[model samples]
Target: MKTLMLILAVIVGLALIAGGAILIAINRNGPAVLDTVDRISGGKNNTELLHKQSLGVDPRQKLLVYGERSPDEALPVFIFIHGGSWRSGNPDDYGFIARSIAPEGYIVVLGGYCLRENGRYPAMLQDTAAVTAWVHENITDFGGDPERIVLAGHSAGAYNVAQVALEQRWLEQARVPAQAIRGVVGLAGPYDFYPYDSDSTRAAFGSVGVGAESQPVNHTSSDAPPMLLVHGEQDSLVKPRNTRALAAALEDSGADVETLFLPAMTHNDPLLALANPWRRDPRIFDAVTSFLGQHTALSVPVQAETP
Candidate 1:
């Protein structure tokens, strides 16, 4: 009995310590804490932190590049936008995604957009388009192939990328050619949530006024780029129905689309699977890499042979 009590005490102590650490991380660093946790969980990786710089006056418009390449070697680009319900998060917080995807023969770009004080539907969309446009104009300096740029995001971010790729107007407004976006990878995104009722949806999108125009599902076209939409079967947050609806719309429009409803996965699990060490299972990572390989000129598998 005494031994059992001692073990229980130790377990409780560890739980308290962990809980406190998490609280501190959340309070001090916001969602950037996930980047630190992902790095720790990933153990060791060869991914390099290539650059950290702001593209415009808004601190939220910062960009972080990840991967190793020669001064003039141009590799296909994969840009990931961090999700925080369209109200929070920044590019640096999603380095785990860059670390996971960059080593597979790509230059990974994590982009930030206006949020909280200066964020809303159109503003966020415009910022995302601007990031793509900026990458197209200057990514060559960072060893990225502008013509093969791909867009990806999670949650609210997923909506932003999907809208930018599907709607066309956002990229057009940013002065970026629509074809410049080769493909899209969306993780648990809300593409058809109109008549907003949720706090986040109402807050981020209410200003845009009522209409299906903001929904990505309404913008599918035969000329739309190939897309991969992933969702958790057990997800209650965004719901797998969102993926199904969007995929059906894309398919009906004669657009290339793929859907993965992962069993037992939750809303954030798809994003968590992108962490390096967590990728040992390889299901989510494999799907993303396969889509990227199909669309990009590299056609390389997830595992790039080392020299």
Candidate 2:
């Protein structure tokens, strides 16, 4: 009887040890990270102005505002969120991406949020939703229309944006309707955080398990806003399958979803091309612009300069 009791004690001890290790991994931050990706990203520009605005207090989030201010022009707004695997990315890293979208007559806001190391799942999502609420309430002062807001982000940012759009609880707390969101775009984001396998992922995310309900795929419904999903065909970091799964889910629910799979690009290349406008591909811009135009009645009017 004593031998059996000793064996049970050992099993209990191992379970406790494994549980503690998982918690530690999930709560740890990756590294300090930091971007304005508004048009005129990597190149010199004498025209566009960059400004910083504080979005909140008590773990304050700062937003980078890039665009031309006008007295009579009420422009569309693109609110950008950056991805760092939930632990390491900074907002300024996506400035080039912001710049490419800004020239299309939108006020681009490249913004930051508290990460998992600082907080956790709902905390990061709350920070994003709060900043977005501030934009809806105050962006017109910067020459943007509150009614024409578009949320765009890469990787984890994409997931956050998708959650806010589908879940609605976050936006509702801020008095912003989910339908007020004109569009949402995710670039190679892990929308489904609850993983079935990959103990590392499970360890990193903790008890918030993955399921269809946890993924953005599970939230698709007829009333949801239109979506644009951009994924690199060769992106192994997040897997192109992630976007494919989401696209299928959205289509199954009758939501307007579009997927653009880029060739010869990886996770970082598409974002880099935003600042190095010379590297920008016409097809990418076309796909995004087409979706935005269809939903928002806005046009880019691009005319090739070359003879």
Among the numbered candidates, top TM-score falls to: 1
Displacement of residue 11 (Cα, Å) in model 2 is 66
lDDT of 1 by residue, 118-196 (tens): 7776888888998898889988887889999999999999999999999888898888887778899999999988878
The TM-score between candidate 2 and the true structure equals 0.77
Cα error, residue 275 of model 2, in Å, equals 2.3
lDDT of 2 by residue, 89-117 (tens): 66655555555677777788877887654
lDDT of 1 at 40: 83
TM-score for each of the candidates: 0.86, 0.77
Q: Show where candidate 2 strays beyond 4 Å.
A: 1-50, 57-60, 196-204, 207-212, 298-307
